[model samples]
Target: MTRTATIIGGGVIGGGWAARFLLNGWNVQVFDPDPQAERKINAVLSNARLALPALSDVPMPVEGKLSFHDTIFDAVQGSEYVQESVSERIELKKKVYAQLQQANPGVLIGSSTSGFKASDLQEGSPAPENIIVAHPFNPVYLLPLSEVSGSPRNTTETVERTAQIMRDIGMYPLVIRKEIDAFIGNRFLEAVWREALWMLKDGIATTSEIDEAIRMGFGLRWGQMGLFETYRVAGGEAGMRHFMAQFGPALKWPWTKLMDVPEFNDELVDLVANQSDAQSGAYGIRELERIRDQNLVGFLRALKERNWGAGKVLRDHDAARAAVFHAQTDTAPKAEPLTMAHMQVLPGWIDYNGHMTESRYYFANSETVDAFLRLIGAGMDYVAGGHSYYSAETHIRHLGEAKLGDRLVGTIQIISADEKRFRSFVRIMKGDEVVATVEQLCLHVDMAAGKTVAASPEVWANLKAIAEGHAGLALPEGAGRAVGQKK
Candidate 1:
């Protein structure tokens, strides 16, 4: 069943919520009094369109409908979920919640308030049991973390159901067992932010230097292992317990001014703003955002390769998406020479020659194999069961070049197959032109035993059927070609 989400207050956070829901196949309705709400949300959606899909190889669900409304009642009337992202003002939030409840008494309400606790949001609500804090970080479409908390009045079911919904939309819902100010993530962020501010106030570091300190050092570590685990590694052979024992004495060293607040008067504000401008004002905000998005894509892809931390989240999400794709395609008529893959050449795939590099052709062919594996029901579960196809031999012929941003598609024709072995040829095309071809030989492996094995009866039957269906087609022109002629 299609789901609907209504967003109130189409600012950065609200726009992000819209993107997250809409891209995940939820019809989104947005209500913001500001005249520029539509334009701002559209801009966020544009960035999301580029960044989100690049995170996974599996195809995403088709986008849901998005409609902008002038009033809260119209937006929330039929929505199953209502996300409130208006200003941080307490009374404003209360007003919105009241309106939302009046509009749809049974719908769940989640507030995108980074600072307010769920109890605070529930203070004046008529339907407090349905309201929860679903605070998400900026660029919510890309980042998976969402801090969720429910008030005392909220039922346990509400929180769990909200968490499941968040997971469906590719978000990690970190539920706060008890409500507290700033939730969880922002508390840690606040500590760092306060230290940075104090450093700036004391003239110890410029904005760029502070940013460099994090990005060039701890930021990379935090992306995967986080602070405590990184420090655990620092403990040598002892691990986290010993590390804390060794470093615990420094707690009173006055190393941080966590309790101090720098006055936000004009002089300090100007000083910080001026330094920030001098540091990064060369590029406009959009360019900086694009650079940030590209860097995130590359970093996340690296982490995905290792299946660690956020990368693990991405891998699991990809598997789920692939499962859905397999289910949908399994019932549909199989296209002869199955269209196994379709994707644009990502920026990282390009070379100095302004075209996709040689290695990427192999990467594309590997993706075709993955898609084919899923199509035949030998997917994640099959691999998990200690059997999988291992490539034994491959021959590739690069016939043409593909540039960045070119849409590439791969089609596979089964050349031969049996219980223990399969061989296939994959042709990659840029539109109608053949860009490359790879002929691959694969053996079914009992992974634990480290040797070839016959595939299960079901898998063998599926492969045999596909091979027989394509038996009448003519052999590809270069099917048997070698590097040297018979001269």
Candidate 2:
């Protein structure tokens, strides 16, 4: 059954929530008085469609329906969940919640308030348990963290439900143990923001310089290892304790003006704004958003490759979806090729020629073959058990070029197989056109002995069945072709 979510306030964060839900197959009902809400959301969705799918190894779900409504009642009609991203006024939020609860009393409502605690939002509410903090970072469609903070009134079940909804939408929910203002992420950001303001006032650095200080240095470490872990690594051989002992006395130093407040004045505002404009005003907001999205996709993908931090959440999401895909193929093996993997041509896959690089073509083939290996019960687990298939000889034929932003499908056909060895063919397809082909000979191996070995009976049974199904099919075109040979 398809689920529905209602988004109140179609601004940046709200539009991001809408895209996140809609792309994850939740029908979205939006209620925003702004006449430009649809346009803004569409713009956000356009960026989302380009960026989110690149993070997935399996194909993303078909997008759900999106509808706009004039009234909160009309919007919250059948929505099981509601994400409120209105202006950060306590009264405005309370009014929105009243209207939402009146329409759907039992619906779970998550607020995207950066500072307001769940208790504060819950004040004077009839259904306090239903309202919780689900603050997401900007570009909500890409970043996975959703700080889920709740008040004492919110039961464990409510918190769990909210967290599960976040996970379902490919978000990492860090549930705050206690209700705190600004939650976790924003509180840390608030400190950094204060320091940045002071630096501008003192002429310490320009906006561009502060940004570079982050992106060029610790920001990379913070992205992957986070604050404490990064500091722990800085501790070196003795670890965090030793490092803390060394730096503990520095806390008394007058290095930071975190406790001091800079006067709020027009001069400071112009000083920051003028410098920021000079730094990045060249690109339009949408253009800059696209650039940021592309860079994040690359960084997140690297983390996903290693199954670390936010990448693990992505991998877990893929695994959940892959379970469904694998279940569909659990029946009899088909006579024709099996479609095993779906991929997008990510930004990093292209070369100077603006086409996919040679190595990426091979990476595409590996993705297909790897999925096939998992299907036949010879995946990572089998390798972990000291027996696996190792590619011995391989031939690749590039029939056509694949460029950036193109969607590709990978299909595999079994050519021949036995208990000891098997030969397979893979095609990397762009729609109906074959962009490339890979044929490989593989041998089952005993890792400890480093020698070729016979296949396990269970694995062989699955592989042999697939091979037999493809026995009647003709050989794929260009199969076994040598380099420089005629087509």
Candidate 3:
């Protein structure tokens, strides 16, 4: 079933969330009071057009309906989920909720408030259970850090459901078990900020120096493993207990005022802002933000593959989204991945021309086979060294055409195997239906003198075996067509 999410405010975070969900295939209804709502949303759509379609690990899930609404109620009229990202004021939030409750009573309501406790935010609501803090970090599409909190009874379900939704849309949702002012992460940052201010005031360190301390040292560790996990590694072979035994004594040392809070005043605010302006003035806000997003995407994708917590979430989300895409599109099941060599197409490969592009089809088939050869240790170097190459000598008659919306596959089967030469017959099929047959002759060439030559002993032997096994494939029916052709 297609999901409809009503986005209440089409500002930066909301726009980003819009992009994320829209990319993951959710239809969105956007409502923002600002007269510039269309321009704001279209800007986000422009980014999503480039960003979402590029994540082609799977045919990206169904894109949601993105329509601008005159009022919040219109946006929420039939939404499964409602994400409110209007201005963050207690009174403003209450008004939004009251308006939202009047629109739809049971649909989940997520506030984009970063710091407000759910208790305070949901107070006096007709159904406070429905509203929860789904506080997302800035550039929500990229950072993926979100803190979700609500009243004890409903918060867990709300968090779990929202997190699942976030995962589907490729966001990291961190649930706060208990709500506190600003929640756990920012509260911790608040503590550090209070102390860091004193250092700035005292001229103990430059702004860059404090930031460098974290970025160069601890921040690298923070991306993969959280502070606690990294500290456990520091404990040595004995782990956290042994490390605590050694370093617990350092608690007595007078390290800086990590516990004290500094006074916040005009002078301090100006001092910090000036320092920030100095640090960042080399680039505009837009450029700086783009650089940050690209870096975060790289780090997040890397960590995700290692099955670290955040990475695990990303991987699971990826798989889930892929399944959703396949199901929605009714894409046919692909052949088992090419452990040896194969080419299979899901429905999305079909083009508007009613046939797959010739170049893309070739590219897809070659990559599938390349992946197989790579697993057996014959990759770029194996061919580039000019020792082994497959030359398409002849492509026979097309048995049938693969239509625009058909699931098709192709396979290359070896016909003959020799140390110096090899032959293969290729078949393109639409399910059980054969569409085309290709026959190719290959040679081991040593381009040292631009001449055909034998490959390395080990490589030739490995190739000979795989080739011999596939040589028995019933010679692709049109094999004789190219036999009498001139060079």
Candidate 4:
């Protein structure tokens, strides 16, 4: 059965929520009074379709249906989950909730409100337990954090179910211990925003300078290690306690205006807005959003390569999806080449010629071959058992170009196999076009003994069965061609 999620607004954050849920295989129903909601949400989904899949190694779920509705009742008709991204007015939110409850009293609603507490929004609601805070940062399709805040009225089941739903859509649900206005992330951001505003109001720094301070310095640290860990590393040999004791006195230095509110007059607003425009207003808003999404893809992909921070959430999600994929297809040898891997051409994969770089072609081949190995039970677990397959020689031929955002399928043919060695061919395809081919010979080796060795009985049976299955098929064109050989 296809799951459905109803989105109550269609602004930047709401559109992001729609993309996130839709891309994760949930049919999305949206309700917003704005005439341009569909166009705006489609714009967000376009960026999402490019960036989100780049973060995964396994195939993403087939996207679900998206529909725009005129009324809350229509949108929330059959959706079990509802993400309310409407404006931050309490009465307006309550009004939306009343309508939602009327349509489906049991529907779980997650608010995208950054400031409103769940208790405040739940006031006078017939189904208060069903309403909870699931505030997310901007670019919700990419960023993983979703602060799941609940009040005392909420049951433990409600909170856990909300968190699980967020996780199901590939989000990190940081359940707040206590309800607080703005939750965690926005509160810290508000402090920083206040300080930055003070600096602009006092003419101490331009908006660009403050942003540079962040993206250039601590932002990089916070991206991976976060605050306390970064400070612990900054403590030389002693760690966090020593560092805090040493620098804790600086709290009284009055170097920051965090406690002071900068006057919110038009003068301050104009100062910040004018400077910001001068800094980044060359590009249109959509262009800036695309640039931001691309940069984030590169950054998050690096973290994924290292398996750290938000990247871990991505990896976990991919693993879960891969589990389902493998379960659906048994380990038996197929009559044709096994579809071993699926991938997207990420931003980092492209080069100066606007084609996928040479290294990624090899990476694609490795991904396919690795999946085949895993299927045959000679994967990382086998390596940990002190035996593994090592590639002996490789020949790659590039036939066509693959550019950024191109979806690629990798299929592997087992040419021949024995106890100790096998030859495999991989075809990297974009739709019906074969863009590249990689042929390689691999040797099973005893790692401790540092020599060729026979494969385990189970693994050899699987590999041998696969090789035998391909024995009747004609050899792939250019399978044994040399570097300069003619077609």
Candidate 5:
């Protein structure tokens, strides 16, 4: 419907959110105070320019325009949703929300703060009921998750409605049951980070070891399934109760500490940096990003065929995207072919240089003939049944340029036909002017013999009847040119 999404920041995350909405057909207006906002946005847009086009399942509508605004109020005037992604400070968010509310009371507002409660930011607002917290991770366009949490003071329906919009734009919207700082996903990450940091502080494992532990071992199991679901599977025949009875003691081991904040100092920083460099071998940020994208593409594509987990979501999204172009799934069947089913020129029939390649004209005429063959009882079904007509020789004469947008029609008249060999004269016309002509001799191919073979009895009868109807017509000048030219 050409909905308007107003973004109040142009940082990495904000720009990603912009790409998601814009790529899905929303007109976006951006309000950023940073002097380098446009530069940063351009960097994000460049990535999106390649990515969105490559994975798009169908033709996208025209690219959405991005407008820059000097102030949040000016930007939110007609916006459907005002995404406030300014500085993480509570005061800054409150100020932005105030500006948004003052501009438009009906507009829904979202803050991009990771751990801030909506109430803290919405307290001093006139329309606190419409403001919610929506925290998305880095590379927002690629990652599907959005931790959509909101305070009770906000309208619950509004938050739910906003989540639906997020889904429409291809996001995984997880609603926060309780308005808590550092919602579900980050809380899980924080728990793992705390334990990993403990190992580094004690010199028990290197940074590489911790990452390898996750990537190679249980990490993969929990990747497509959450910890609980994975454990449920592990329980196997005995299920959760029996499995927990046998292995729950490990949860209390001295090696695992639930609480320990490692002090951030030079030694700790160097420990992390050295271990990281050792693990990945000093890859640049861009290279790492490219690797991440390739891996995600591979993972997502594999998941699409099985229609499992996040892959199913991706599959559904692609289907929805395809609906734009493939709405004619049940359209009527194509027409039967006449005279070897000659076809006219399509848009890409020729190159930008404005001359049809000699090879392509023959192919186009052959396609038309193939369609007519289908009408005469030889089609893809016949080929699948181990029979086909293969062209052995052809002669073509190009009289003029087959320029772009030219509508050319082709006609094929059978000169002779038998079980072993058949000949046809193909002529191309632009209006009444003859652009080209082809005289092709084709062999009835036998798949098993890998050689010319006689046509089947049924095929011979059909061809004989069709040939007899046009027996009185004179052959074109180009006809019978194999042995000698008619001229």
Candidate 6:
């Protein structure tokens, strides 16, 4: 069944929620008084369309329907979930919640208030049990973290259901067990923000320098390992307790003015704004956003490869999506080899010759292998069970070059398969032109034992079925060719 989500605001965060839901195949209805709400939402969606899919090899679901409505009632009429992203004023939130409740008493309402407690928002409200805080970070469509919490009036079921809905849309829902003013993520952010403001106020560091201190230092570590774990490593052989005992005294030092907030006078505003301009004023907001998105995509993909933190969430979600895809198409006949994967040539894939580099062909072929593995039901659980396919050998034949911005598709043909080994050919195409071919030989391995082994019976059956399906097709021209020519 198709699900529906309604967004109450069309600002940056609201638009991001819309993109996340819409891209995940949820029909979206947006209500905002801003006359340009549609334009704003579409712009956010454009960036999302470019960045989000690059995080995974699995194909995304077809985009769901998007509609704009002027009245809040019209938008929330049939929505199963309503996300309120209007102004942060409590009065405004309460008003919106009232209207939302009136429109649909049974629907769950998630408010995107950064600082307001869910209990405060639910105060003096009918159906307060249905309202919960679902705070999300900026660029919501790309970032996976969504902090979920409930007010005192809210039932446990409300929060759990909200988290499930968030997971369905490819978000990591961190449920805050207790209601707090700013939830968890924003509290950490607020601390950093306050400290940064102090630095600016004291002339200790410029905006750029503060940003560098983060991006070049702890930021990278925090992206995957996070604070306690990163610090635990810093603690050395003794681990977290030893490190804390040694460095805990530094917490009392006057190195940080975290307890005090700088006054937001005009002079301070101008000072900060001027310094920010000097730091990054050259690039427009959109250009800066693109740069940020590209960097994030690259880092997230790296983490996905290692199956750590947010990358693990992405990997798990991709596996689920692949399962649904295989289930839906299970009855379909196998005619041509499966069009397993497709991707655009990102800028990083270009070489000195201004064409897609050789390494990317191998990467694309690996993704094709991943698709085939998923099709054969060899997924995370299969690998976790100490059974997996390891590439034993690969032979590549490059016939043409693909340039940056070119869209490439990979097609897979099963050549042969047995209990312990399998071989396949992947053809890389730019549109209809064949650009390259990769022949791969793989061995099933017992990961724990580090030795070759026969695949599970089910996996072998699936591979045999695929090999038989492709038997009628002509073998790829270069299927068994060697790297060297015959003497």
**Local distance difference test, per candidate?**
0.86, 0.92, 0.69, 0.92, 0.73, 0.88
Off by over 4 Å in 5: 52-56, 277-281, 327-487
TM-score of model 5 relative to the true fold? 0.68
Preferred candidate (TM-score higher): 3 or 6: 6
Candidate 3 residue lDDT tens string, 1-487: 8888988888888898888778677898988889998787777666555433332344455457788888777888888888889887889889988988998888888888868888887789888888888888777666667787777646467668877776667777778877788887788888778778888988887678889998899989987888789989999899999989999999899876877766778988888888988888799766676677656666766776677766676777767755543333211112221122233333335567656556655554564445435533456887676554555364555557675335455455667767776675666667687776656676666666767776677767666666656654555556767544643
> Using alpha carbons, what is the TM-score of model 3?
0.70
lDDT of 1 by residue, 1-487 (tens): 8899999999989999999999788999999999999999999898887788778666567689999998888999779999999999989999988888998898898999989988888886777899899999878988888899888788889999999988989888999988889988899999998899889989999999999999999998998898888999988898888888999999979898898889889988888899999999999876887788878888888988999877888898888876765553332224368887775676567788879899989998998888888777788899999999999989898889898557787788888899999889999989899999999999999999999999989888888888887787777768867776441
TM-score for candidate 2, please give it.
0.85
Local lDDT at 64 for model 1: 92
Pull out the clashing pairs in model 4. none
Q: Model 5: clashing residue pairs?
A: 340-369, 341-368, 419-454, 419-455
Candidate 4: residue 318 lDDT (0-100) = 87
Ordered by lDDT, highest first, the candidates read 2, 4, 6, 1, 5, 3
Could you give candidate 5's per-residue lDDT for residues 1-487 as a string of tens digits? 6788999889988988888777777889998989999888877876765454434333444467788889777777678887778877888788777777778887898888878888887888887888888888877776677888888887769889878877877777888899887888888888899999889989999888888889899977775776888888899988888789989998788766767688889999898888888888778765676677666666655665678766676667766765553342212222211333223333334566757667778776776567556655678898989988888988877766676435465666666777776677777777778787788888888988898788888777766665555555677766555544445
The true-versus-predicted C-alpha distance at residue 160 of model 4, in Å, is: 1.0
Cα displacement (angstroms), candidate 4, residue 412, comes to 3.9
Please report the candidate that would top TM-score against the real structure: 4
**Model 6 Cα displacement at 392 (Å)?**
13
lDDT winner between 2 and 3, please give it: 2
User: CA lDDT of 137 in candidate 2?
Assistant: 96
- Model 2 residue runs over 4 Å out of place are 331-368, 375-377, 381-416, 419-459, 469-487
Judged by lDDT relative to the true structure, which candidate is superior, 2 or 4? 2
List model 6 lDDT by residue over 291-347, tens digit each. Answer: 999999989989999999999989989888867755543332285687877666765
The lDDT leader among the candidates is: 2
Clashes of each: 0, 0, 6, 0, 4, 0
